[model samples]
Target: DTRKVAVFVGSLRKDSFNRQLARALERLGEDRLEFDHVEIGGLPFYDQDFDEDYPAEGVALKQQVRAADAVLFVTPEYNRSVPGVLKNAIDLASRPYGDSAFAGLPAAVIGASPGAIGTAMAQQHLRNILSYLDMAVLPQPEAYLQFKDGLIDDEGRVTNQDTREFLEDFVDGFVEWIDRQRG
Candidate 1:
């Protein structure tokens, strides 16, 4: 059986490296997993007052999160942490006091950046937040991709041989973890 993975891209930019990384992961997981890119760009900032009467976008986002077999976060670092948009989405989905959609869900995080840190700090921050939401995140083979020009081609393929191999291994490990969790 195929598992449905909800992919959350943190950046709203049309040509974000993180988005490209997500596409690469999708290509690598094509056989065993089906990917859906959940749009967070339009989600309004989370508010507790609207918890009972969630907006349509927020409700749709929650539904998507709840229906998925797993979650994949492709984030970019901003000021050494996760972007406000992603954090807002997390807060929105983890609301209504103990009715978090992410509770006990299997998750993995990966990101790409032009900087040397390669979104390491952002992933760490996200990990802490996901821990609070009680997600079963994969612990090894952490992917913090450093983006260089031509690292990814126009066809959404990872061009660097080393990065390609590493991402293949990373996705393999993620798939294995998801299967184990399914069992």
Candidate 2:
């Protein structure tokens, strides 16, 4: 069966490595996963007052996430932590005190970076937030890819054989995790 996934990419850059990573993952899991790239760039900074009358963009974000079978976060480290934009998106989705869009969804976090540790710190912080939001996040086989030029193409093709194999395994594990979560 195919699972719909709401993919949240943390970077706003037009050519971000994290976005490339997300695309690669989508390609790798295409047989079993249908990816919907959620837009977070245009969202206004979350305001509690708007909860009474949520903006159309915020409502759209929540609806998209709720419609998905699972969630995937592709983030880049910013000052050793999760990027502010991603945090804002999460806050916006999980707000209004009990109308969270993320609750109970099976989720996974992965990132790619030019740095050696990839986005490890950012991923850890994001995991904590996801846990608090009550997401069933995948805990094993953590992927912290050290991205280099030509590692993955803009169209999500993994050029390196080793990297492709590793990502394939990651995708397999994620599919299994989603199945287990649904069961």
Candidate 3:
């Protein structure tokens, strides 16, 4: 069966490595997964006051996330944790208590970074938060890609064959994980 995967990229830069990874995952899963890159750039910071009467953009974000069968979080390491924008998006969707859009949703995380750690700490921080959000997370085949220029082409394709194959395998495993969650 086809599944809809909502992709959340942590970086806001035009050519962020995490964004490139997300696009590569989308391309790899083109046949089995319908991927939607949810825009978190315009979302306001999460505040309890806005939970009741959320802004139109926030509402749209919630709806988009809730409608997806699964989530693919592609993030960058920002001071050893997730970026503020991505965290804000998460907090925005999980609001008003017991009405969190992310609850029980199947999710996975992968990240790329310029540092030697390859976003390891950031992904761990995100995984911990996702657990609190009650998301069913895939635990294996974790991707911690090291970033480099020219890794992804203008066409959103990964240039390195080994990296491409690894990502493809990760996508395949994610598909299986989603299926397992459904079952």
The candidate scoring highest on lDDT is 2
- Ranked by lDDT from best down, the candidates are 2, 3, 1
Which ranking of candidates, highest TM-score first? 2, 1, 3
Off by more than 4 A, model 3: none
| Model 1 per-residue lDDT tens digits across residues 1-183 | 689999999999998988888888898889988998898988888888887797888778889998999999999999999999999989988887788889999999999899998999999999999999999999989988889988888777888888899999999989998888878
Score every model by TM-score. 0.97, 0.98, 0.96
* lDDT tens readout by residue for model 2, 43-66: 999999988999989999999999
Deviation in Å, model 3, residue 16 alpha carbon: 0.8
Please give the RMSD to the true structure for each candidate, in Å: 0.9, 0.8, 1.0
Clash pairs of candidate 2? none
Q: List the pairs of residues colliding in candidate 1.
A: none
The candidate scoring highest on TM-score is 2
lDDT tens digits by residue: candidate 3, 53-148: 878887888899989999999999999999999999999888868888899999999999988889999999999999999999999899999988
Candidate 2 ranges beyond 4 A from true positions? none
Candidate 2 lDDT for residue 7: 98
